[model samples]
Target: MQIFGITSQELFGQLLLGLINGSFYAVLSLGLAVIFGLLNIINFSHGALYMLGAFLALLGLNHLGMNYWVALLVAPAVVGVLGVLVERLMLRHLYKLDHLYGLLLTFGLALVAEGSMRYFFGISGETYPVPEALQGGADLGFMFMPLYRGWVVVASLTVCFGTWYLIERTPLGATLRAATERPQLVQALGINVPVLVTATYAVGVALAGFAGVLAAPVVQVNPLMGSNLIIVVFAVVVIGGMGSILGSIVTGIALGIVEGLTKVIYPEASGVVIFVIMIVVLLVRPAGLFGKQA
Candidate 1:
């Protein structure tokens, strides 16, 4: 199978890998975008939270012999519960202050979480094993893609789009949006606006947790993982304008593949390409590819 003399197999292979990477980015950025949109907080701890998810999954595996499927169920719930506790105890206080304070607080929280993991797990990274069930490749005529990797791509996209649809096209989503814009008005209607806000934050963090669990098999689970990839995610959110969920999802996946393709060509430039794209996008359309300025 060849197209334009470029083997369809090779092209599709890279594209598939790119889409997998993009799915993680999309979901991760979606979490960031949600926090930014409603809480007006940058969530500097997002990367830390993500690392925590993977670490927690590793713990489930090592101590309890839990496999990927069980870890997938357990890890996110634990992390999400932690998120809700943080919201009730920490973020709730910052909601009335300057956004920078929230950023600083979350930054400190990230440091605490990452440092604790390093203390226990050591600074060295840990590996996550693939289950026997997802250990083979699927031949699709044009490409032979790994089952685990393909699942990661599909699952991430499903979660990302599902969240978007829930938020953008549902009655509950309408109320959530309204609450973000005018909390007092929504509260006056007898809705627990603060509780709703906290729930949204927890949901966003849980999505991050899910990403971490899914990512364990594909990437090394490490204390430093968050710091390693967070800046790129932040750039993705910025480039997508953080004003639109769809923008974040699309831009994240597109940029990931763009980076992957760059790796195939000029490997040296791959590291900085995302930031370069960010700068270009900001200069041309500060609102981002699918965003609208407030």
Candidate 2:
């Protein structure tokens, strides 16, 4: 019944939870990787955008009477549009400037977004109810799994890989890659690199938004939600090697499982486990597991 000082049930449950956490980690880091690869900007506002996505879903549910399913689609679209605007109005100008400028500007925007939300919402979390359709759990041999959480894992994996395939296997993705590698050549070939840049940013933020919506039912929707998770995601991005789509996905899930195991074995270390792994990765391979050294 017990495995390594913990029950099988407990282990399975924690592992399931870890997978769910990893789902979010993978999506968020994937977005970060994508944006960094193309735009060469570290998007500090990504967390804010994620927070906004959750709030947008909440708004849709509370004000517009939209269901969770609808919010899943609508929330990302709204936030994606916001991302495009941010790129056009703010980020685009900073592209030619130092990377530090992008970081600072986005960080400032994050502060403003969080501050505004706190002013209105008072930093209290708003609950988004799990949809009626997904309000149950499945009884596995070892443990019971929440339907929504299981859905999160499946949905996250599907989206993560689908994005990977699109970017890695398709012509659009090929064009996007070419644009980043050789913008002048892409432009000469009449690919409209600027438009592609904007669209890539939009897609990246949309991924963040999608993750947020998936998370809202599982966690309280709050201004600080994105802030809390972004750090871990960044670590995942670093450990997996930034801009490596598959690397991000695999590392995120693996770290999540490791975090879960730590919680079971040593609860106190759970909080810092991912960062600890990150430090170790930094020391061992400065370029990360899948990263190439410049």
Q: Which residue runs of candidate 1 sit more than 4 Å off their true CA positions?
A: 1-10
Residue 194 of model 1: what lDDT?
86
The TM-score values for the models, in the order shown, are 0.94, 0.98
For residues 1-294, what per-residue lDDT tens digits would candidate 1 score against the true structure?
665455767667767777887888898999999888877878989998889889889989999999889988888888889999999999989888998999999999999998998888888778999888999988887678899998898888889999999999999999999998999999999999988898889988988888999999888898999888789899999998875788899999999899877765676998899999999999999888887865
Best by lDDT: 2
Q: Can you write out model 2's per-residue Cα lDDT over 81-182, one digit (the tens) per residue?
A: 988899889898988799899989989999999999999998889899999999989998889989999999999999999999999999999999999788
lDDT of each prediction vs. the true structure?
0.87, 0.91
TM-score between candidate 1 and the true structure = 0.94
- Highest TM-score: give the candidate number: 2
Task: Report each candidate's C-alpha RMSD, comma-separated, in the order given.
Answer: 1.9, 0.9
Clashing pairs in 1: none
**Counting only residues 3 or more apart in sequence or on different chains, how many pairs clash (N, Cα, C under 3 Å) in candidate 1?**
0
